[model samples]
Target: MVLELHVWGPAFSLPSIDPKCLAAIAYFSQAVPKDAWVLVASSDPSVSPTNELPALKNGPTWVSQFRNIVDYLRQYSDGAWDLDSNLNALETADNTAFSSFLESRAQPLIDLSLYVSSQNYWQCTSPAYGDLLQWPNQWLLPPRIHSAAKARTAHLGLSALDLDAMEDQRKRDHSAAVAAGKIPANFIQRPRDTVSKLLGRTSHQSQFRLEALTGELFEPLEAMLGGKDYLVTADRPTSLDCLATGYLALALVPELTFPWLRDAMKSKAHSLTAYTQRMRHKCYGTAAVKVADAYPSLSPSPSPSHLPWQTPERARLATVGYTLINSLADNTPILSSIRAQNRLRQAVESSKADLSDVEREALAKHATGMKKDVLVSVAAAVGGVVALLGYMVQTGFFSHEGEEEYEEEEEEYEEEPLEIEVGEAPDAFGVMGL
Candidate 1:
């Protein structure tokens, strides 16, 4: 019987961006026969019984949660690896407790880093989903996902710091740092510099919050992981390893939203990083390389291809229009300087004879007129793009008719499960407790 794992497209060299999906991938990577299992990178949530990715279709059985999938594989599959098979009842209870603890404690940080942190969400996390979706969805889904993530973070009280307050605090800190000669006064101001430094700062409340959470969760994991191959002192990989590897893999990535989290993971939970790397190597092996190339569609699609316009001709027109708008939106002084230089060069080249003062004045006037004409042309192009987009929207060119048909087909496949076993899904951040 074939096993199919439905998961989000791979990103950041992991099986999926969602830690739960990564955990499921890690667990089943060891359990199922390579030929028997198949991975489907899909964005549609309607196919799953629970409307989530990382759901598994094991022959006739459908399991949605990671733990439920693990249980199903263990019960029915031959040669399925079970790390807790030999553990005593006491150790089993400890493993279960630790797994729950780790999930509850670490999930929020992951959420904060990937979604709440603007740097990671915009630059890294959101773009990761681009290729998995088509037009409008490729453009539309990310903001929705970002909004949902922000809402979740706000609900968790991590986003309680008011934006204006944070900005004011950051400015004060930056000013202080410059005065103290800690940061060069002339250092190039990057968009990420302030946020990065703020998150990295030891004294910042956000940093302290992150560190406290890191210590609470990772310190115990580090203690348990001392000289052990796996989190649970098991000779083989277990469910805990799957969960640990997921968060650890994400935390260890240098491009994570919170660099402090990466720094903390490396400095405070160094052992876990090593453990994660080892687990990755042992389970994935050459599959990682294959994943990178074979799953090109898993990466973000090229920007030009996913425009919402109906025809290639219209998309091309829109691209030109947008380019003109971008050029017009540049700093006025910079654009003025550029225009002045170009006018000077053209005036010099166009002069076939020594010009009188009046000729020079006339040339200057013509150049000024040319600049106005250029601006008018740019404005017209922008207006054209807007009008084109409005027409497309009115005509329903962006409507995804095929998606409705696809969903209809999916509805037929949504059958009553041969076996139903639900387990508490691992929360990225477990409930706060020791």
Candidate 2:
């Protein structure tokens, strides 16, 4: 039977927005024969047993997550499709270690770029999700992903990168300025010049922190990759290479509103950038030409191209309802907690079964993210109910006992639009990438 790999759909002209999904794509592209399998960008994670994307299916059997999928694929064909087959025992162990290291170090950085960065998320990442998902999913997935990203990167102390956090800071600064009663200078501004300067400092600090983070991930990888096209051997890519390519390609490829990740990769580690392009072509073919086009400076010469893989399955009508149901289940307080608890229990139980340490950590992270999501959803639901009640009361639609109801004419007021400067300053990463 033909294998079916169900994953998140294309975004930013890449096969998948998710790194693990991209890793799976790369693995399949290199190892499995073209006719043996087909990719289904179903985008509905609910189909998987784990209710996660990047699920590989071989008839009745299924596997989720990147490492698990790789392990499963290798075992499926008597090592025929094993990319790491050439590696010795020690090399295989290193492969696993480096893969985990790449994930643990690289994930938060990716999160910071794609989700924590306000402008990037709104303008690029969220819109990509919108394109990949159907109606209700478009409404639901991005914010949860953003929340998860924030939680993952919370240790980095980079709340300044968040749009909501920044907006709140601006509001607090305005309040502080007004409270100080200093009509002193730059008063009639969205934020005073002084406040802007403060924001600029915070922005710089965040940039520096992000640079440090990028170095922590890329530097070691670059050293490990010293003069080698692939991570292990120059002959061909192994599982470790697939994992590395998945993470590095996303860092180098996507043209985000915040180009810090891409810029940092190009400037800080040229070899890694070139390695990513090589892997990209090997895995994605012409579909990844945009990756080269995005970084034309790095790739000045014309690059070879080949026929792209078949287009993935589009999100269908059923996907909309499926996402809605899952979203509701995920948001309901007690129900969500129970689900998360159950998931964690399952992860624990499956520790011995087949779930690798990285995949297990991911599942645990999902549980943590679910708790936060439930809290947010509860607050939103409560707030919406209160707002509806207030609207009804004001409109005299819902009368209160022992209270007079009256109608009043709505007054018109001239108000300029609230223009937000979503764009960062031109010299954004000036002090960083050293």
Q: Against the hidden reference, what TM-scores do the models get?
A: 0.58, 0.73
Backbone clash count for every predicted candidate, in the order shown? 8, 0
Tens digits of per-residue lDDT, candidate 1, 1-434, equal 66778766567766567787778777767666566676766554445655567788766666777777777677775434565677778878878998888788888777777777766666777677775554534654576667766666675555422233466666888889999999999876545344655545533676567668789878999999888888776577778888888777777753654465787888887778788888876654534432233244434652221101111112245544543453454335546545664646565555333578787778777767767766777788789999999999999889997999899999988887699789988775665542
Model 2 ranges off by over 4 Å: 172-200, 289-319, 351-434
lDDT of 2 by residue, 125-187 (tens): 988888767667678877888898899899888887776677777778887877898554466
Worst ten-residue run, lDDT, model 2?
Answer: 404-413
Best by TM-score: 2
Candidate 2 vs. true structure, TM-score:
0.73
Q: Model 2, residue 99: displacement in angstroms? A: 0.7
